[model samples]
Target: MTEGVEQLYFHRARGLTVTGSAATAIAARDGRVLAAAAEVGAGRLVVVGGGELSALPFLGRADNARFLLNTLSWLLTGQYAPAGSELAKAVTHERCFTVRSFHPEEDLAKVEGSHVVDARPYRSLLERIGGGILPDPYQEQAAFLLEAELRFDEMPRVIREAVTTFRHRSNDYEGLLVRGLPVDAELPGTPADPARRLDKSTWLSELWLAGFASALGFPLAYHQEKHGLLFQNVAPTPHNAANLSSESSAILLDFHTETAFHPHMPDFLMLHCLRSDHDGIAKTIMASVRMALPHVSLADRCELFLPQFRTGVDYSFGSANGVQGNGPTLPVLYGNPYDPYMTFDLDLMVGETPHAQQALEALRSAVNKVQRWVRLEPGDLLIVNNRRAVHARSEFSARFDGRDRWLQRVCLVSDPVPSAADRRGSGRVVETVFAV
Candidate 1:
């Protein structure tokens, strides 16, 4: 009975025993009557053999969603419902299922004019915060983070407001760039050793990273990654230059949501640059589902919402993190349908079915068409909404002489209650043993 619907999915469906002449078999699977319809007075009744069609998860698969909507419209109006019409899209369960409209181009344009903050006026305040010798950021993180939070009000108003707005408003742009921030005049060369990079006297850029990240949410560290350091280093290492990680320079790092396979993923990821690549061409690219959704077809969008894909754990998290194989099957897109959030890892995510595979390719092409690039400088900081965006790095030449591009990275989450069990004794670091 669904208009313009050529296919419908059925799981363990039974035959509808049609006895009356008024009953009509509109859909059938093999020789079984999967669906039937009957007209009564000014209304109609539709019987579906598959009871699971009412469930949201089942409705999103194949053409079942459209069939349900069109059937509902026909029953209410006693006429053939035209496909892609407003009448065919109405549902009686709107109260339980809700969605808001989102225009990515318009929302992105509104934030583009105010993404960068003039940091020259805040140099004195930044110097005061990072000038003193403080507790080690990694070893004594509690004390160090408290020190940064205490000075949150002293930060620039533009940045403070921007961070607050970006945190609360989910439809805003995916990335924020802060330029002219203060950094250490004489910095050590980019060290390959993760621990050796943390042995620094001055803060400056690190302070900026902490202040902004703390203002947005709680800064997090993974026990299995980077020795659980609050501020992890992102620089090319000779051993990992050909690998698929932030330390790789020989290969293009594919786009991914930070820690997509983890249960308690970060809400925000901040990258503060301390140095630039030798050629200054290694660009960081980011793409949002909001920007790419407009380019995708309705059929592909429906397929993407189904739980037909799996994401693998990053090698950086190590293989002993309790997660095995491809972790769990999950949908690439979730949350509000119009303004949704997505988790995608180009190198680690795979579609489980043929339809999902085609949809995944559609998403990949859309993201590639709308991707934006940013070349970070020595005094620049890029804060990304990790849930709404996926980020990647371009391939660049790296010299082993310790002058390669260096960036300090940190993650934040709006709410920590969901991950409370994973954290050890109220610490910022999440224990890898309990991560699944």
Candidate 2:
């Protein structure tokens, strides 16, 4: 074991001349000094030749594990030994390996009151303004939705309850689904491909989306994705089916916290279905941490709290994405252990330690054990609390026969006024300004 460690990590660093060598190499390989000691003013520096020796993968090597502790002890204590003397491993307690136990604060509660709404007055109001309400510039359309909300002077009891349930207890409910929205009679067929240009006229149910988002909070947009469009089209496009994009990707589309890597991700994401797939199996699935936490063992919970995982930025964030290091190391769960904030991605987050890998697997197992399922149809709007739940879509075949499934998607934040202050000009899209 000692010979292997010496050969692997301490090779090729022997010959550098040191006038003030406080420590010297005793187990070097290949005619070089692997370990050496030097001084800088009042401080001491222990230099290891092969930087890769410190990586996580090499930490399990017997001497490799002891090298760190011994080096730190000698440097901090200012201890010195003769040129040919080697530093051996020190004594340590055993409790470091056992995890402290803890319990999650909340249980995974299924979101209810999500599929109820009254369609009469809403449809009547739109019918009164003809079958269309296309306004120039997106801001005007948003403004019109705000003003038109007055049409429902007395919101239907059920719709009022549904909207109210979403605002005050959204974090608890996870999301709300409103059904029976007014769909246009003469609807355009499914888009054949991704938009070649930005076009708001193609919005399936603009007035409803804007009004719904306004009632909850103002809608938000990102400069990095969908060309900064405040509201984007979600449909099965041949171009994106193989990718992970929520807009048009139809392959299984794994569950993920929307923009888990973004510092200023939306607080809510709204999706209203304009058409369903020819087959009815493309159900939208959501998993809430509230429900999954109860199943996590205490040891896994402790491991999950350590910042040993890195999540990669989603592709939609655009070029230079790869250059950016995987986002800062952070725990899968943060904040109150009972009701913590969760940010994860099966495709992106990588664990750096054994405990982290164990925690990731435990969390994934818990999430996979339970889920909320919804099948979208015309006039159905799904409002997901972007903070508490991870969402995904079931795979469905897209024939591209102009009958593909179509939905309108939008990103929304609770308080747009503050975000607006940071936003440049009057544009709806907020670019990189704040850094977390």
Candidate 3:
């Protein structure tokens, strides 16, 4: 093992270095390609010489796997951004590995289904670590959790396979639910303060969900709210009834991406329910633009794919943090236009032209016609593919009697954060892109 190899292990690996001028991993040793890539005709190609580049990218030595995955991911997608590591320079080409390319479709999406895990095996596993999945220092906890064999080894095989499928095949639905995690039947009271808190015991269940999400993508955080807390408590607050924040009043939260206006939004979002609302009527709604697009006219779809709209920062960003200039005029849909990624905020985003406005409305109607709803219960985790679909919360009456709905939410980013350079410590929150 090299001095800075992080903890990646490869079995009987052979050394394969680029004999020609193609760029290579930084300081490869013991047959490891820390980095390397090149353009092959119209397709991109990457050769990782070191560690295991096979199967799961986030399981073994997730730290180094990120470097390996980012190298291949950028080449495949042609969306390259520096990882802020002085150790290696950026590669110039892209290629796709096992990670499946997304295929945009014109059909209405199917409702997402749940993959349940048995609680008995998980309970026995918890006894080994005193029932807590992560160690102290919350900001640094995710890395430790990722290293646990209990999480990686014991995750239900069916659930594991489904996650792999989503990672490879472009999904045509909103999100999937994972049920039967260990949660206390006797629940904690819903918190009311700005510092909404949960007990460590409760965190154990959510930690399992986080590990599941980490298997799909890198755990990511924002710098602005709660000083960029990795696990944010999504609950009702009296002051935020219409604020357009995740923690805003639980009055019908609109269907939108977790962070649409920001340049570095998370690729996936996992919301773990800590407590269910009293009436259970507070359903989480998701709308697949893919499913709705078939109903939309071609003209409206064309306008949406064009840069005819601009969006404002969600209130959670506050008024002071980032991108305060006139919001950039951006297309609602971009990327592989056939299987496009979308950015929309019904309240904060506005279409510049009447045609754009009509397109937005048409899109809303199309999505609404095929919306799917799920009311998450305790021990349930919902993973939304933020790239391919939009999610919103329905208006729920908040009794505020310590039993209102409570969910712990976290975001995942695939690429190494471009703002990693500005992170002061904790290595989680990136303050580089905004005016901090």
Candidate 1 lowest-lDDT run of ten: 90-99
Q: For model 1, how many clashes? A: 0
lDDT of 1 by residue, 143-235 (tens): 877887777677767778877877787433488877768888779889777544456667776677888888888888888778787788889
**lDDT (C-alpha, whole model) for all candidates:** 0.76, 0.64, 0.63
Question: What would you estimate as the lDDT of candidate 2?
Answer: 0.64
Error of 1 at 112 (Å): 4.3
Model 3, 83-132: lDDT tens digits are 52322212110111223323332222222233223344655554443354
Q: List per-candidate RMSD values in Å.
A: 7.5, 13.0, 15.8
Error of 2 at 35 (Å): 45
After TM-score superposition, the amount by which residue 108's alpha carbon in candidate 1 deviates from its true location, in angstroms, is 10
Q: What is the lDDT of residue 168 in candidate 1?
A: 81
Comparing 2 with 3 on TM-score, the higher-scoring candidate is 3
Say which prediction, candidate 1 or candidate 3, comes out ahead on TM-score: 1
By TM-score, how accurate is candidate 1?
Answer: 0.77
Arranged by lDDT with the best first, the candidates are: 1, 2, 3
Better of 1 and 2 by lDDT: 1
